[model samples]
Target: MLTEDFIGRVVIVLVVTVLTTFGAIHLFVTFQQETSASSLAVVTRTGTIAFMVLQLVMTVWRLPPKGTARGIESRVTSVAGTFLILVAAFLIPAVDSETVQVTALCLIFVGTVSSFFCLYWLGRSFSIMATARKLVTSGPYSIVRHPLYVCEAIFVSGVIISHFSALMVALGVLQFLLQYRRAKNEEAILRQTFPEYHAYERTTPMLIPSLSSLDWR
Candidate 1:
């Protein structure tokens, strides 16, 4: 399981790096452009509905987890992230009306596509339990170890950007931090579970386009 654990840790690192880069870019843009607080309520509501649907599906489907900390932290992050998003959706006013609309569209598209890709990759091996029964190293795992979690970060960030709430943006950053911590713990457990994880780590491209790049191969 070394291959799997190593691959998982590598993917987590990549995801965190990408998020940091994106966060920097987003902050720069938001600072330059004035945001609206009026549309926050509407966007937040729609986002909440979408998030709720996803949560319900995950709950009903129930996937295995890596460890207790990973499992518990996942739920906490979800709830906290949801609450922040909801606040932006319901209470914050839209700062830039036109931009807000565009932002929402972009967020929805990116989040949906990323999330669907993760779910498809996870397939039947997906579970929400606190411990994993098997190492998933095919499909998305073959490409990036933790596609679902990576995409989740994307989704959360997208929603925050869609709402254009400064407070929510900060909270989203905190959410990511929490997620990274959880991933760190999960990776340690995965390392203990799998012996082949290191070999896989050397080959996979983490959260980037590993399989996609291989299409030409």
Candidate 2:
């Protein structure tokens, strides 16, 4: 017997699946016709679509039971984080920055590709709200507590460089700040739930990965 709450979650999840799939197809089709598109545009569009695909997978299969949220801050910051992850790339002006180079394009691709590993490691632990699921301590998490956010910083920076816009610039900055706050709110919950979180926090920098602390192997 499916409860109303469970049915609601399923319905919302299905809706998200439809939206992300449609969004990915739309972006790809739009970009496919751009035979004259620059390398930066090509990479940015591809990166955005790849990100959407990964997010769809996470939401559909890999998510854990969402824990109790802290407060309004948790939900608000979660929305902000989602906006950055899903919508910000599309918000970037389709026009090329005219300043992009092959090197920059390469960096963008690298950031986009590298982020998948962290997402894979995160697995079912991913959540939009400040809720505890599993405390991932290996892979990129060993370096920075919020590896996904760090990766997004790199990936989004690359996208912004490829397609510059004043409004996107402001949104990017705001997203970065909100990501930090969102991560903090999550850490707060983790600290309360798990005893080991204090030591983890002490050793792991919140967002920026310290070279000295990172395991090189």
Candidate 3:
């Protein structure tokens, strides 16, 4: 008989796989229709699609948690932090400025590429919730303990900038708080599971990279 964890993993993987497939198809169709799209737009859309696919693949193959957060609060915060900013992006009307659009695209592209590398470093250790699979402390992780969140802030900043509304700003602030909380929750789990996590925490900055401790390897 399949355990609850196995069933949950299957459901999560299936949901992500379906969402990725549809999202990729929609992006492809939009690209095809926009015959005169800018080069930046092309690159951004392609990178976004690639990121989605890669994320789906990673979710399907991600490691089982060594320990998970005990309560519903951690799960809710994790989900909201991961997805609420996206709601603002889709709901708010973007500014009608070519310069702003270009800047937004550049930020999005850079964030996407950087996030791809972070995900690569994370590999199977990635989790949507506050679960400790493995402690990764290399690559971008060496720069900051929560490099993925930093990349996400970059991406979401672009979105919020493009849609410069009061509501978007509010949502962005809320998302940031949720992400911070989620990071803390993850740290708690990691600290509980791994003895070395305390040393790593002491050495690494939470979100921002320290210029002194920049380690690429």
Judge candidate 2 at residue 203 and give its lDDT: 88
Best by TM-score: 3
For model 1, the superposed segments whose C-alpha errors exceed 4 Å read: 1-44, 63-96, 124-130, 208-217
1-217: candidate 3 lDDT, tens digit per residue: 9965577577666755665565455455545643333334444445544555665677778898899888889988987887676544534555555577688787877788788889989999998888899999998898899999898888878767666789988998999999999999999999999999999889889987888669576
* Residue range with the least summed lDDT across 10 consecutive positions in model 2: 3-12
lDDT of 2 by residue, 51-104 (tens): 656765665664454354546777778766655634655544565444563444
Q: Give per-model TM-scores.
A: 0.61, 0.80, 0.83
Assess candidate 2 and give its TM-score to the true structure: 0.80
| Error at 137, model 1, angstroms | 2.3
Best-first order by TM-score: 3, 2, 1
Q: Model 1 has how many clashing residue pairs?
A: 34
Error of 1 at 109 (Å): 2.1
Model 1: per-residue Cα lDDT at residue 176: 73
lDDT of 3 at 35: 34
Better of 1 and 3 by TM-score: 3
Candidate 3, after superposition: displacement of residue 208 in Å?
A: 1.6
Misplaced by over 4 Å in model 2 are 1-22, 25-29, 32-35, 38-40, 97-104
Candidate 1: how large is its RMSD?
Answer: 10.9
| Global lDDT scores for all candidate models | 0.54, 0.68, 0.76
Task: Kindly list the per-residue Cα lDDT of model 1 for residues 55-150, writing each as its tens digit.
Answer: 445444544444443445654553454344434444444345666666665666677667777676555444432345456677656666667767
